[model samples]
Target: MTKPAEAQALPDPSGGDHKGHRERLRRRFRDAPGALPDYELLEMLLGIAIPQRDVKPLAKALIRRFGSFADVVTAEVEDLRAVDGIGDVAATALKVVREAAIRLARAPILNTVVISNWDTLLDYCRTAMATLPMEQFRLLFLDRKNALIADEVQQTGTVDHTPLYPREVVRRALALHASAVIMVHNHPSGDPKPSKADIDMTRVVRDALAAVDIQLYDHVVVGRKGHASFKAMGLL
Candidate 1:
């Protein structure tokens, strides 16, 4: 057995508290000469929520599980929960960060000239809708010369389908007095390839729009893999 004097020689558990431990790491990150790497940044962010623990292991676990920072942010809630330390709070926090980034990207498109700012429109669409687990069909209404009038979600449906009504589309376009419109939807399977139904539906919308002298500018399909543009693909 150990001696009575040796029993009191154990290291004190409260020698350094949470704040001191975290401050040390923060100082290390701040003092690094060059820019901190992506993983290091992630570590800092994770530290905000999970204070008291060494976040490097958790950070590595997340990167390993999701493959990349974007993948981690875009991961489904269930997928994020599968990680050891990731709880509902952490997952939601990460999702909010992703959404904030998307909102920032979309700010330039909100009131700008839609024709010249097509890139921003694409960025907003990809960020807002592409990461969804189900399909959502949306419309971007524009007036003459392609100035955006409204952005609306027309329908939400299963992974493979949505109920799109050309009459409703026309009615909304007329209400907004939009001269042209762009159609957008997501493919949950991450394949943006247009199906036969997609092609047929576009034709129906085009014909319907013609009745009221509105134009179908293009159809854009967003997916996790990439995006497909009907105009670029010669399908418009």
Candidate 2:
């Protein structure tokens, strides 16, 4: 009697059969989550989206293409699909995970005094904006107690610059009944240092807000390198 076709197949170079390997990965994740490196963690994630196949090579390809686990998830879907085994389903899975993480980070700061939870707010900002491909100007509107009232992306621009209208910012603040606001934008160039243009635009917004008696709390610039706070640097 001939052996079953699956039994005749050669072992996967990564290890045993695909199903067995996937179970081992899950067991490792459940037993000691931190033990798995980026590639292994990503391997497991990809398995969920592409069952019936060994995903180790695909996972490593993603890491090599994007440089890290975070970068892979934050990558544009079309870019993700360009990888060898990543399809619409796999790319969407990665994006879903990224969105879940951003929402998790953002939950703590909603309706809370943001300055009191400063670190969490920074974390939320980085998760939302750090990996974006272009510049995005965002506003955090605050009530009298400094509790966050709204978070809005005011404009999105090219890889290097965003045109921000000070009058429009103030108009939105007044309409929202916001007592104060935090300005935020990202640098795709990975340096959070404020450009001369960034500083001048910030000053223009500050003055416009002042006319409406709405305080400008800070202007934070975020990037892959880190974040810079205008208030902390005495630029505000």
Candidate 3:
């Protein structure tokens, strides 16, 4: 009697089918052309977050909603949830990616002298702060030579405003022994243009610090569009 055709066609149970597929993907990723497209990179990342499902559609949806890789990673959790197939798990995954990017961006400013890397410093500050839906006031404390000592979030407020106290800023600088400082905040409105109040508040902080012999290096306004430096603009 002849054996059944279906049984004859089946592969041996010991064959490494599961491992082979993953190795093929790994090889393709390593050998792929310049810049392994966003989807592929995202696919690899999502494979960690969602082990059992196809993540292409979700990744594509995120890109479509947020416009680019950076924007998607930086998007607010609520905005991320608005996309189809994005739930708590996906939102959390995107947030983890964003947090990693922020930490990477700030690495240069952490131990090294920040004054020398002004661009990276601003990029770090902006990337780290601009994702918030509400306003935030942050201070980057620096030593006498302008090396970063600590980065602190002083206050968080509503979508439009954050209460800032010049006296408190000065006091904190004194306590930290920070000879110089950089002030940074974000506007949820996506315009980096500094408002009159922003300028006024910056002057208040600057003057207060100046009285205590602490330099106010810059007041950086971060928004989705970009960042503006008050000192560079001659506003300080």
The numbered model that scores best in lDDT is 2
The local lDDT score (0 to 100) that residue 120 gets in candidate 1 is 82
lDDT of 1 at 190: 87
Please provide TM-scores, in order, for all candidate models, with all chains considered together: 0.73, 0.89, 0.77
Q: Please, what are the lDDT tens digits per residue for candidate 2 over residues 1-236?
A: 44322211324455448788889899999999999999999999888877766888889999999988988998888788777667777888899989999899999999999999999999999999998887999999999999999999999999999999998999999999999999999998899999999999999999999998999999999999999999999998
- Give the local distance difference test score of model 1: 0.81
Worst 10 residues of 1 by lDDT: 1-10
Q: How many backbone clashes does candidate 3 have?
A: 0
Residue pairs in steric clash, candidate 2?
none
Using TM-score, give the best candidate's number: 2
Better of 2 and 3 by lDDT: 2
lDDT of each: 0.81, 0.90, 0.80
Range of the 10 consecutive residues with the lowest summed lDDT in candidate 2: 2-11
Q: Best to worst by TM-score, what's the order?
A: 2, 3, 1
Residues 1-236, candidate 1, lDDT per residue (tens digit)? 33222111334344446457567768888798246665666777777766555666677888888776766787788887777667766677778878898778778887667779878888899988887767899999988878777889999998789989999999999999999999999998889999999999998998899899999999999998889999999997
Task: Give, for candidate 3, the lowest lDDT window spanning 10 residues.
Answer: 3-12
Instruction: Supply the global lDDT for candidate 2.
Output: 0.90
* Cα lDDT tens digits for candidate 3, 66-141: 6677677777777876665566676788789988988899887786789899989988877888766789999999
Clashing pairs in 1: none
In TM-score terms, candidate 2 sits at 0.89
